[model samples]
Target: MTDKSRKPVRKAVFPVAGLGTRFLPATKAVPKEMLPIVDRPLIQYAVDEAREAGIEQMIFVTGRGKSAIEDHFDISFELEATMRERGKDMSALDGTRLAPGHCAYVRQQEPMGLGHAVWCARDIVGDEPFAVLLPDELMWGKTGCLKQMVDAYQEVGGNFISVLEVPRDEVSSYGVIDPGKADGALTEVVGLVEKPKMEDAPSNKIVSGRYILQPEVMRTLENQGKGAGGEIQLTDAMARMIGTQPFHAVTFEGRRFDCGSKTGFVEATLALALEREDMAAQVRQIAARLLRG
Candidate 1:
C-alpha cells in the first residue's frame, strides 16, 4: 500500500551509463548525453526538466568515460570568469548550475541495463518516490513532461510513467500499458508488457523515458533477473508493482524526440533550431533548399 501522504518527488535519477554505440566515432570520446540538441546538451535539457518539476537533488548513474557529464554539471569558476571577461551572457549557464549539495553521481561499474543502472542510485533516492528522466528522450512542451507527470503524481499518489500513443504496429518497440479507467490525461495502468509482439500488445499507449517511481521498485530490481534484451529490464520490475501500487500512465502533452537514434537527433536539432529566433530564418532557408533539392 502507498503512503497516502507520499513524499513529493524531490530527486531525479538519470541513467547515463550507456556506451551510445549508435553514434559511433563521435561518441567514441564524447559521452552521447553530452551531445548538443540546439545549444544545450541532451543531458541539460533533461536536468532542466527535472528542475522544473521541483527536483532538489539530481542523481546520475554513470559508467566509465562519463566524467564529462559530471564536469558539465559542476561549476567552472574559470569558465564563468572568462565568460564575464568576454561579456558573454552568463544566463546560458543558469540551468546547468546545481547548488553544492544538490547533485550526486554513482558509477554503474558495468553494462548491466536500465534497471541495474537505476538500482545503482538506490542509496541516494532512499525512501522517496523519485523521477527518472532518460536524457536520450528529449521532450518539448510548454511545461516539462516530468512536471506534467509530477502534477499528476500529486493528484493520484503512486508510481507514474510518462506515456505516448504510438502506432499499433510500433507497439512492440515500447513497453505497452494495459490501461484501465481514464481521467483527463491520466490512465490507470493495470499491466505493462515490455516489447510485446504486436498481436500481444494491450494498447497503443507506450511508456516513454520519464517515470515517477516509488523506492520500493529498487527492492524489486534487487533480485530481478534479466528480461527482454537479456538485461535487468526496468519495465519488468515496474510490471510487478502494478497491482501492489497505484501505477498509472500520464500521457505526455508534448513532442518527444528519441535522441538515441541519429534520425531523431537530427530531427530534434532541426526542430529546436527552427524555434529559435536567431536561427529560425537561416534554418528555414536551409530546410527549404534541402527539400527543394
Candidate 2:
C-alpha cells in the first residue's frame, strides 16, 4: 500500500545532454546513450528501468545531435513492414516502443552541468516530485534501481537518492554522503560531498544516478552557481534542500556499471552477455578462449 500522505512520483527526467568526449571517435557521430549493452542501448536500459518504476511520463533533456534518440522511440514503419513480410520473429523489439504523449523532449542549449540540464525541463516537470536516471550508469538486478528507489520513496517520501558502497580508494571519484542514521536500507543523508578527497570523504557509500527529488529543488538550481568543474553542479543544489526536507539515501543491493568509462562499458557488456540464455554457453567459451590467447 502506498502512503497517500506523500505525493506520488509519476514523472521521470533523463539528462542526456553530455558531449560524450570520453568515448570520442565512436561518440563523434553517435550519442553515448545510444551505445549498446548486450543488444540494447544504454538509453533503453534507463527507460526500461524508469518504466518499471511506474513512471507515467519520460522527459528527456537532449542536445543537438540527439535526434537519433527520438527516432529510436518512433515507430519504424519501413523496418517493421519488412520484418512482417519476411515473417521474422520481431518479438525482440517488444518493449522498445512507447505510446504517444508518454514522452517529451527539450533541448539543453549549452553544455551546462547536470543542474542546468534538469532545469531546462522545469515547465514540463511542473510542481511534482520526479525521478532522474542517468543512462551512463547501467544498474543490473532482478529489481531495477529506480523501482527500488520508488518503493522506498512511497514509504517515506521527501527526497531519495539511490546509493551503493564503493571501494574506499575509489570514493574520491564520486559524491560521498555523510550518513546520520540507518534504518534497514534507508539512511539519513546529513551531507553530500562531490568527489571529496580521500581523507575528507564521510563514507564509502557513493551516490548512484537514480534520484527521486522534490520539485522545489528546481528553484535552487535556478540561482545555482558553477562549482567543481566550473559547471553548475546538481549535487550542490541538492545539498541545500537536505536540512529543510526529509533527505535519505536508499542503499542499492545490486551491481552498477559506470558505462561512461571504457572498462566499465566492456565489463557490463560481458557480464550481461553471460546472463543470456541464448548465448551464455557461447559467451563463456569465447571468454575462456580470450583468456588462453
Candidate 3:
C-alpha cells in the first residue's frame, strides 16, 4: 500500500532528554524516565505504547545521564542467563530487548526545549509522519493511548494529537487548542495557543503528551522562534502548521498522569499496581489500611 493508503505512522520519536530535576537525589544518577512505576520504567511504557501502535522504528532523543535508558533496552545477558538457569520463560523478555537495528538513539546535547529535542531527530525521522510520546506523561487506558490515536489516523490522515478536556481554571498550565469542529472524539483544530489564560483559551481542551505529528513539523520547528519560556516550544511549531496542514485533536479514552510531578508519580504507581492481577489485592488492602491510619 502507498504511504497514504496505509497508515503514515511508521516511526515514533520519544523526547526523553530532560534533566528530571524534580525527582532530585534519585535522578541525580538515574534518569527519571528510568524510574519504575511498578515494574517498568517510565520510558518503557511509552515504548510499549508506540510498538503497539505499529511503530516500526523507535527513535530516542537522549541527553547526559540518560545512558541507563539505553542500557535498559539492551540485552541483559547476565540477567537472562540467570533467568534461564531458574527455568524462567523467554516470552516475558521479548519486547524488552532491542535486536541490533530495531532502535536508534540521538543526543539533544543541550536542554533547549521540547521543540529543539524533537528537531534533533529530524534526520532520522526523514520525511514521514511520526509519533511523539513524552515519557513523563503516563497515560493509562483500556488500549494504549497511542494505539487509539494510531487507529484514528487511519481514518483522518493528518497530524493527530491526543487531546483532553482540562478544567477552565487549569488551562493556563497546558498548551490549549482552538477547536473548530467535533466529530465524536476527534476535534478539528483551527488554531493553537500556548498556555493561554482560562478566559482567553480557545477551548477547555488541552494537548496531552501523545502526538502523531507529520514530518513537516520538524521543518517548522527547525526555524521556529522562541515561545512562552524563551525556548523553542514544540507547541509553537505545531501551531504554525495550521491551515497548511490538517490538524485534529483526538480525545483519548484513558487516564493520564503528569508523573513528572510528585503526586502524579505516586498515583501512577498505585494505579498501575492495582491493574496487575498479582499485586491488586495486596496493594489495595495495604492502601485501605494506610487510609484508616
Q: Model 1: per-residue lDDT, tens digit, 1-293? A: 44643678999999999999999999999999999998999999999999999999999999899999989988999999999999999998987778898999999998889999999999999988899999999999999999999998888799999999998999988888999999989999999887889998989998899999998999999989998678898988998998888898999998999999999999999999998999999999999999999
Sorting all predicted structures by lDDT, with the top scorer first, yields 1, 2, 3
Cα displacement (Å) at residue 163, model 2:
0.7
Which portions of model 1 miss their true places by more than 4 Å?
1-5
lDDT for each residue of candidate 2 in 1-293, tens digit (9 for 90 to 100): 22432688989999999989999999999999999989998999999999999998999999989888988888899999999999989987876787899899999999889999999999999988899999999999899999998898888888889899988999999999999999998999999988888888999999999999898989999998998788888899999998988899999989999999999999999999999999999999999999999
- Per-candidate TM-score against the hidden true structure: 0.97, 0.97, 0.95
TM-score of 3: 0.95
Candidate 3 — which pairs collide? none
Comparing 1 and 3 on TM-score, the stronger one: 1
Query: Candidate 3: worst 10 consecutive residues by lDDT?
Result: 1-10
Candidate 3, residues 154-238, lDDT tens digits: the string is 8877888898887899999988888998999989999988778888998999889988888889889977888766888888888
TM-score of 1: 0.97
As for candidate 2, its clashing pairs are none
Better model by TM-score: candidate 2 vs candidate 3: 2
- The local distance difference test score of model 2 is 0.91
The backbone clash count of each candidate, in order, is 0, 0, 0
> lDDT (CA) for every model shown?
0.92, 0.91, 0.88
